[model samples]
Target chain A: MTTTSETAQAAPPAASTVPPKAASRAVRSKNRIDPTYYWMVVPVLALFAFFITLPALVGVFFSLTNYAGYGDWKFIGLSNYVNIFKDPAILQSYIFTFIFALTTTVVVNIVALAIALGLNAKIKWRTGIRTVFFIPMVLSALVVSFVFNYLFSNTLPVLAERFGVTPLATSILANENLAWLAIVLVTVWQVAPGATIIYLAGLQSVPAEVYEAADLDGAGSFRQFLSLTLPLILGYLVINVILGFKGFLGTYEIIVGLTGGGPGMATQSVAMRIFSGFTGGDYSYQMANAVIYFLITLLISVIQLRLIQRRGVSL
Target chain B: MTASTFSKPVNKMAPLGLKNRSGRTRKSGREGYKVNWWLTALMLVASLTVLLPLYFTVAMALKSPDQIGTGTGLAWPNPMNWDNFAAAYVATNFPVAFMSTAFVTVFSVLGSLACSSLVAYAIARNWNRRFFRGSFVYLLSAMFIPFPVIILPLIKQTALLGLDNPGGVVFLHVLGGISFNTLLYIAFVRSIPVELEESARLDGATTWQVFRKIIFPLLAPMNATVGIFAFLGSWNDFLLPQMMIADPALQTLPVVQMLFQGEFNTNYSLAFASYLMAMAPTLVVYILAQRWVLSGVMRGAVK
Candidate 1:
């Protein structure tokens, strides 16, 4: 690094016969360290270490013990971990959380991509339509869930009854078997617009010349889209899927607002379970569950970073 | 490949009419002006579907008690009863909740901006240094650590330190938001020319002065983005404040609204009215800053 800077400085004055070593030293001194930069970063780093890193480490320690969130007793290594696997509620939450995340990721991606494609076209009222779609992206998830709860409970059923639809006569949120679907519907509604914006950006970046070239070869629109557009936006798809999946795994407020984990805990996410544990005085067991959850997210994040790096996704 | 290459030169001088035809087709294709009315109509329906819940909330909020339980509540309220809002305002203690929410949002936005930008500036300016680079990576990794992973111990730690109030929640919000905000600021800071700060430094301005006078002013756009994001996150947040602030008087708007909903579950008008009240601030802000919010989502996604 030092040598490159030296050569760069020396290249501008090739006629001068100055010593390379001396010139490099001069440039290095010109780039002298500012102690204030170190000072400026201290508070941020301190807060990060104390508030984030320390608590995380403490959490890991507590996961192995019988810490009731307040007065602690002796450590019981792996007991909480063992109990987590045996607990039906935690296991059920894990299953529901994964199901919710996977289903939402797939559905949101397809719908978002479709919306992006439509919005990208030269249609009338494009900006107005885009804004309408994107409005939910800015609203609070909790608020949106509550609003939807009313619709599912009151409005939709009333409409269903008027239309003579037998199945929808009852509120969906009150049904154990179907309540998770309502949560998924709301999640998709709230999240698809944000994904649509990302996909729209990706769509905009696809070169028009590629499609034009394909047209000259007599390739139809579907073939052109398949052969040209999807490949170019594959990176964006990976990003949306990973980020959306990880985010949905942390779902809490929406569940609280909609069904409050449902008629029988059928829709409880891992986060809901963890919070309940805190309130229920099952602190260490929930700490163990949280640690496992942390590791799963960490693994997925690592995989995502690696995939982006390998694909060289600039966006 | 050889045949196509040789034929391309010969076909390059094809009829002018044919060329124009192809050119027109290409232009039309590029602009996508061949309107698909079906798709346009479909998108309109989808937008309406997405807006239905919001429409229902507002409609329900505007209805009276008699109008709500009836099927006609789906339609607009005839008399347009405004009493529900008043009842909701009283029941939820809207003034106290609104104040608490505003305090958390404003302070969190301000604190996150100040700390994250300073650290970001340090890292961006000292890009070649090992420590700063390490700091950047360390901060970025914090993004992977979900809040639930540490909430149990965090509650204990905060309680032990006697910081379990709205103030504690604000501090946590500022800290929790620093990683992403710092990342955004670092990207913006890198684009700012160092010569401005260097020249100021050479003129004997302290490093703090250089940052305060030059660098900070240059980061106004990023400050807006981060501030809006921090505001949204803090305002919408329920879990941290719900867990941290035990006192009913100190609860944020979302938590208060949730509790309020539980108390007045049977009063659909008052319930929906309070819901609208809770959501109004964000909706207003979103409408005012829709352009920035949209662009910011795209930009943040790119990172």
Candidate 2:
């Protein structure tokens, strides 16, 4: 090592005395490891481990026991996991969560994309209108739900009754089959602003020259949009869909505010199921359910990262 | 990307459109297109989806119980019972809940800014180190663990540690945000030239001193981005405070509001009034800092 360092210092004229790679390696090794870097990183890492990582691991461990969130436990092996598959309530939650997420993702993207296109157009009061559109993005989701709940429950039924619309005369929140639709309406109302902002950003990134060129080629606006705008903003669409889906899968506050997961558990998301199980004496069972939910989310996140990387998107 | 990326297109394209408008009048060719009023009208109607609910909230909050029973729930109240706000404020114990929420949000924002940026600076500067690279990956992996998966155990752990309160919620909020906030900061930090830090290092500044003096000041835009996210997240959070906070009085606004909601006996006027109060701060901030908040949210979404 000493000889390598000395030779590295000797000069380029005597480069053949020692292999250049070895000298460079020795010099590189001499680069100081700052202890302050450790000081900067370790505390945050330890906190994260203690708060997030340790609990996750502990939760997974408990999924294999009959701990009841407290008391003595027996190693139950994969019984909880097996029971989860057979359990009607758990199965219903997974189904409802996936369906809700899928529907909401599709609806949000379509509405947001259309609104983004309008905002992107040459319009009057563009900034003001954009500001108005994003109001829901900043409000608490629970509050928004409660507000909409009153609208759906009281105002809508009165109007429907006056108009002689039989199907909607009563509150939809009381209907087991239609309550999820109400949740979807409120969720879309609150969530569309966020997806719209993302869509607007993506739309703004596309160069105006692309549209100008299309116009010169005798393409109409619709043709240009389908051919040029859609392809360019597809990355944002994919992102909004995946991120929105992942987010909506953890739908708790909105459901609680709207239906309290009632009308016979019709709107209970996987998150609600897990949370309710905590107080419902189904702790280890729900932990198992939670572990499964975690795996699904992990898989989706992995896929999202891969897609983003492949598309060369920074986020 | 910076906040300016959001408005750059509008600034650039508006002048182009104006220039095209002048040329189009003279030539009458396909140099420009007119503003589509149909789309504007459609969007205006859609905007009611946002406006009507808010209008309903305000109208409901101000209506007397008698007026609420008489109308289709759309008319503005003439007498305008302003007493609901006063009543709901006292019933929800608005001051305590608001302060608790403010405490959690403020600390969460401050802690996230301090801890995540420090971690990012260390990792970004020492990118060649294996341990630093490993740490970044470890932090990034936490994003995949859904909060529900760990929430139950977290409640148990925090209770055991005597943290079943708003303080614990603040701690988790900061810790939970580190992964994404660090991701955002690392990307931004990599863009900052090392020469800036090298000068400070040559001045014999320790790592902490260099970070505090030089890098933190330069991270203002990212600090805005991360701080906005942390504030909004901690402020609006329901699940954490609902399940984690043991004392009813110590709970944050969202959880307190949830508890205040009892069936069959709920006064609609008071409930709506309470929601409006809880929503007021977010609305005020958004109105005051519209540009920065909107652009900050946009910047956060893609990166």
Whose TM-score is greatest here?
2
Q: Which window of 10 residues has the lowest lDDT sum in candidate 1 chain B?
A: B12-21
Worst 10 residues of 2 chain B by lDDT: B11-20
DockQ, cand. 1 = 0.34
Q: Write the per-residue lDDT of candidate 1 for residues B272-298, one digit (tens) a residue.
A: 898899888988877786766665555
- Global lDDT of each candidate: 0.80, 0.83
Error of 2 at A229 (Å): 0.4
Is model 2 an incorrect, acceptable, medium or high docking prediction? acceptable
TM-score of each: 0.88, 0.91
Candidate that would win on DockQ? 2
lDDT by residue (A175-199, candidate 2, tens digit) is 9999999998889988898888777
Q: Could you give candidate 1's per-residue lDDT for residues A1-315 as a string of tens digits?
A: 354345546555543655544343334443676577888897778878988899899888888888776574679999999998898989999999999999999999999998888877655676577778887776778878878887888777888999999799899999988999999889989889878877876775676588878878989878977988899999889989998999999998889889999888899999988877677878878889999999999999989989999999876
Clashes of each: 0, 0
